[model samples]
Target chain A: MKGQIKNTLKGLMVDFLFWLYLFGCLYYLLHNNWGWTVRNKFILITAMFFTGLFFLIGDSLGRKSFLPTASTNRKWSHSVWGWLLVIVLIVTFLVGWNIVEVNPYKFFTKFRNAGGITSGIFDPSIVGYQLSNQSLEELKLDGVDQEILEKLSGIIGKRYNTRKVCRDDLKRILDEEEFRIYGEILLSKTEKNMTMLNQALTALAETIFLALLATIFAIPFAFILSFFAARNLMPHTFLGNSVYIIIRTIATIFRSIEAIVWAIIFSVWVGIGPFAGMLALMIHSIAALTKLYSEQIENIDHGPVEAIKATGASTIQTWIFAVIPQIISPYLAFTIYRWDINVRMATIVGFVGGGGIGLLLMQQQQLLRWHNVGLIIWLIAAVVWTMDMISAKVRTKLTSM
Target chain B: MSYLLEIRELHKIYEGGTHALKGIDLNVRKGEFLILLGLSGSGKSTLLRCINRLIETSSGEIIFDGKNVLQMKGRNLRYIRRQIGMIFQQFNLIKNLSTLTNVLTGKLGYVNTIHSLGFRRCRSDVAAAEKNLERVGLLEFRMKKTRNLSGGQQQRVAIARALMQNPRLILADEPVASLDPATADSVMRYLGELNKKDNITVVCSLHFLSLARKYGSRVVALKDGEIVFDGLPSEINEQKFKDIYGEEAEEVEIR
Candidate 1:
């Protein structure tokens, strides 16, 4: 009789907690203005009712008892351990979604806006704007309207300056699709676009060079630090082990901070340009390469190390003859791979005044110059693709050697 | 009464509590080729390693050339290591290095490590490396990497490397364990020749009783980390063999 009473009280406690938690969550959602309104109250209650039923059924399944007595298929309730966890996840997901107030309509709008912007960026306007009077005569021969041709010549005579024509004047002249001939004429009248394109190309060169310089500069420091950081080399003695831990900890802390954050600090240090970008990349690569190279050291065959030591070689002698030969090939391979990674990151580092194609891209994007942005994007893609191919080939060659 | 190496009550309890060597006490004469006979885990490897201080002993006294090897640190330890050469079952030559370079590395104890890194060994160093390689009959293959050599040839290259040390003592830890019958004999022959020709003290461990009988000037048998028999190869009678091997073992397998 006592055991039966205790069982009843335990079941009652579990059921009470489950129901209370369910109701409390619903009340909190309503109180927080998520669904307490008259129109959404019905939807909210319906959702709550379904969830409540799911948990109630799961709880009954957990206890192996039901309102009417579940039948032959009730064997599933024997494994009630997994049910509570599933219900908890479902409840948390629903409550969290409600808390965040995710709207499908708003998500769809964002998707649509992103699609429109992507389309605009891909549609590069390559029409030249600097047409001579002789080109206007040629336009006339192509059956362009006489008045539009005259307006076109006026644009060319002004050396394609937007300042020469009012905003409304230029827009009106190029407004109609039929007068796209004149639009082409206006396109042929802009010299400024060509200069912007030239600048983007030059900035792109700087970005590539910056990444190269960073990786190159990082190699010497990273190479030296790797030997100290290697657990096998340094952890043999207490002092060496402490040095290993210290170097490893510092490298990890630096690795956690992204290259851009480093770039920001370096831009302040060296004054914004490719040099600052190179410096930031170099520092980040040092931390990254130290970790990678030391792991390489740890994985090398210890047989040669022992063999060298048995020859009665000194500490540095063991490293020079045994350790150095094993690592040189892998070191070259990793450096090439790092150089490839740096090139891709170099573009973004430019946004913080670290001077690269990315800086011009930031400006062009903000100014809504989709044509210039398109040009920069294509150029960067080309450079990165080339680098990827070259680095892969070089890495294979180096490692294989 | 005279000995080149003296070991007293050596104990090696590994970190995880494996008593690999339990109070080993032995002595090695200056020019004797001593064979250590034991089953697997009989502390041959541990005892050999402790002499070189490759694995630190738990407690012991290992006196080599009147200097206590157990108490050595830094340069003193290295100096002693230079006098005693060691070869493993794996041959342990840097695989990517040429046969000559592998042999040249044996002289690393004498040259500055930084200076050695330049790949430009002095004329005498080169001549010595060549001489050692020739001694092992691998002079023709000096330019080839050790990885390209056969198991027997690689072992010989390793022997040549040990010779570069002009080692006063050579510790061979199951050097022929990995080789087939004929190849094992050839490798053992090189060690035997080195022992007789140079009068270098040799402490070798071997699993096969036949190799022990053929090569050992004196044999020390270990059973469960303690010396069971210290005598000549001819003295190991059938009953004695049973005590050393711990079972009724056939002479056929002993080969």
Candidate 2:
């Protein structure tokens, strides 16, 4: 009886930890000022609801009953169907949240009216002038003195005169008008910045293209190097050991230096452009992926190799039949994982003049346009999250087969 | 009858300065069921594996089918290995693969690397694998992963895989050490039947003396890497085995 109580307490502790982790992640998401979209609210509520439902079921079923108290049911817990259900639930929740939160409509609409007229029927500059003039009249009616209003009207009139105004005089009049309509003018500038949304989209597209190009060049090189890096495949000799050590050391050195640093170095060599970014990402990816692929190769079972060898199969044939099949799943998984990482790194590498979304983000930061910076951050997050979900699905489908 | 395998002055020295096999000489007649009996580290397994060149002998001339296999290399070595089938104590089937695939891998020597990588085995190879599995009474379990089967079933699959090789010689290194007495007897019966029916040569290393006597036509005893006794199973009386293995032989439960 005492033993049963101990087991029950242990179960409760584990449950508490799981709930704590879930809530902790949610807390961080909210604290990061990640915005209060409908998706976020749904995730928060769903997580809470599940936590409650799981505990209720556990209590009704008798904690030990839900867990595998006997060995026979342990097999059931480890079954493919059980794992599939859990994976499906998690993926459905994640993808659903991502789709709703990253609704492209909101992103595109935010910048819809920035620099261009939405309908093309009227110019924004002409509209801005009319709106400013109307706002001035409204201020006058709200008990503003006529002297101040007349001064504001004169300043605006001087700035927009058709005759060429002296540059110094125009600058002085613009400054006075800005001071008079401080809050209103600031809001109008923000709205105008939104119209230049195409710049952000172009930056995102360029970064994605660079990432894909780097991955294409890196995967093959990494695959070749992994053959020498695997310990089981290499001979038990000084030459083999030295070759493995050298390749491993070189890969480690490349991977250890951040991609951003690589980009800065490449930018100096090739001058500024996406070419420098691609080279940087390629070097880092080759290093990282070689290590990953080599580990996969080493962990493959030696049984098939022995079987092949006993059948008089050549060394190359043995590798083809025995080694390749075992490692294919891991290779696909690692490649997709690398691509996801490369996309994120490509943006960072752009900060060094390697041309991507990071370039626009830096510009916005320099301009102190926090609202525009917020929009860019959201767009980047959305793209990365979408890619992550797609890759996860692909990985699941491949490995199951 | 002409000798199918001959080993002369076989000696193996480890890098750590331990002698695994002292000077040893033996000859196996064609189509004979020979059993090497010894306790752990008595060099029975080493002697069996040495025939296929799985482990290199330090100083020896191993002549298999009139060819000095010790001096063979590249294509020649693989050609010899293909004719000599080997089974392990662990059964050593690839756990993740189905029984049919594991059996089919025996024909890897005949298939090209490209076909193997593409998983494109010839139709005949597939049929042969199925036939071998049926012989082992595991045709219905061919699609199941090897790990899902019991120990006896796995050992049967291993034997089926070996048969797929159509080998001239089958080497079993402690094939029944991991099984229960009943399973061991059944496995030995199958191996004995194969030898009698197909006239194929077999060299099995065994720890159980009674089992060796029950199935083996000839017993080769090794003590400390030296061949202490070699004769018909009936000639290997308890007194003779005692002389070779010393007082420790009494502790061995032959039953």
Candidate 3:
């Protein structure tokens, strides 16, 4: 009992230290700039809202089995339904706090005027000059006082007429100013929003497509490569050794670089956007897949391969019948796993302008609009988490079946 | 009748510098049930593998059906393999696939790459697999995953798969090693029947002397990678086995 307690304490200490070190490193990376911003606060609120929503749905649906359970039977926490209720309560509290305190609406309407018109000199001056010139021409045609018409024309030239003027002309100038300012703001917002959305979808599509293509292309190639890699398959030592070393080196080099760094490098060469992201993902995927597929090939039962070869089955035929079948499950599982990782990484690649949710995230941060940033982050997190769960479920089903 | 396989001065050195088969010579006649007997590390498995070119010989020539199997390449190698079948100790069936799919792998050489990768097989190939599974008395379990079957049942599925190849030669490398004694007996009986009924040449390696005596028409004994005795099974007496096996044979109780 004493020894067990000591061992447990040691393990706990190690775990604590590891987490502490991790958090410390993270703190260093983010530094003192961890103060709340409008965008981050908005994101926090949104995350809390969705988390609460899921929690409530989970509680109402009685889906406690999905969560990890505690060993001890503490009535409320022990049962799945009880756990769901607790989670729902916690999420609700957090969300309520965020909504009340963070106030996402403040960020949106901060620059907006009370009348929904943007108060700015440039737009009004342009509109006023145009309107006053037209009014002067009308007055001249009507043969009004020469001094008044002259004053209006001179004021329009200076573009600083701020008098009450007639209600019709004033209304027209106000409408024109509002339309110009709102149009510019709306266009900018829409362009940024659309680019961000398009980048994310394109990156996701390309990553998945390329991952599938790489899986197909790499499987047979890796099988053949494994033949050379496994000492048992080759006849000569020199050839097999050389081939193994070459493949090993290539795989190592490709896998060594982080996907984000790869995206940055490719972005420079390809000139930014989703194309760069796709190429980066493809390169990393090939390396990762080749290693996984080759290992699967190496570990297969030699008896069948030998049997096929003994029958005078060609190398290709032996691999097809004997080796390929044995490794199919792991190969597929790995491919799916890599694809999930690629999708998640593709989002981050956008930070380097390779296009995705990360690009939107950067823009929101730059603009100091925490609410939009929060929205994008929550969306990405939810997508990644859901995909992870789905992939895991699929892998389990495939392997089990 | 002309011999189906001839090995002259066969040698194999493993990567670990172990001399597995040292200056070995053997011949296998067509339609013969040959058993190779030896203790662990005696090179019986190596000799069996060398015949199929599964384990390439360090220095030797293996002539099969009058062609040098060592020098054969590409299409020729595949053509030769199509005529040979193999069974393993672990059954080596694809665990995720159904028994029928595992059996269908035997006909992979005949299918095109596109169809094979696409999971499409010729109708006749599927029919043949079904028939082979029926012959092995596992047709009822055809759609079941191989991993779900008992060890003996899995081995039967493997045999059915081998049979689907329509092989002329079958090399079993410790096919019964992982099985219970009863299952091993049944598997051996199946092999014996296959040899007699199909006129297929069979070379099997066995650890048990009784099994070898019961099934083998000819028994070849190896000691330290060298062929110590090669004769009719009846000629392998206690004294003769002792002489070939040294002091180790004394501990072996032949049932």
Q: What fraction of correct interface contacts does each candidate retain?
A: 0.71, 0.60, 0.50
lDDT of 1 by residue, A5-52 (tens): 665455545554554565556566676766554444554555556445
Q: Which residue segments of model 1 deviate by more than 4 Å? A: A1-28, A31-81, A95-112, A115-117, A120-129, A132-197, B117-119, B248-255
If both were scored by TM-score, which would come out higher, candidate 1 or candidate 2? Answer: 1
True-vs-predicted CA distance for residue A81, candidate 3, Å: 62
* Residues B50-81, model 3: lDDT tens digits: 77666678999888899898897777766666
lDDT of 2 by residue, A1-401 (tens): 88867776665555554554555455545544576344556655665566556555543122434344333244545543344345545655655565467667867888865432232222211211112465566666777666656655664432221122223343454466544554344224221122335677888899899988999899999998998899988878999999999999999999999998999999999987889999999999999999999999998878667766777877777777678867888899889888888999988998887788888878876875554566677778889999899889988876664
Better of 2 and 3 by TM-score: 2
User: How do the residues B1-255 of candidate 1 rate in per-residue lDDT, one tens digit apiece?
Assistant: 479999999999999999888888898998999999888999998899889987899998999989999888988888899899898898888888788899988998888766876768789989988988888898999999888999999999999988889899999999998999999999999999999999999999998888888999999999889999999988888888899888877565634
- State the C-alpha lDDT per candidate: 0.81, 0.77, 0.68
**Candidate 1 chain B: worst 10 consecutive residues by lDDT?**
B246-255
- Indicate the TM-score of model 3: 0.62
Deviation from native of the Cα of residue A165 in model 3, angstroms: 32
Report candidate 2's fraction of native contacts: 0.60
Cα TM-score of candidate 2: 0.67
Of the pair 1 and 3, which is ahead by lDDT?
1
DockQ, computed on Cα atoms, for candidate 1? 0.69
Candidate number that wins on DockQ, 1 or 3:
1
Please give, for residues A1-401, the per-residue lDDT of candidate 3 as tens digits.
88656654554343333333333333333443464234444444554454455444433121232332242134665554455455556655655554467666876887454331222222221122123344456556777667544444443433222223333343443356543533232222211113333444454455445444544554555545555555444445677778877877887898899878888898999987767777777777777777776776767777666555554445665667777777777777877787778768777777886665666667766875443454455566766797799889888875654
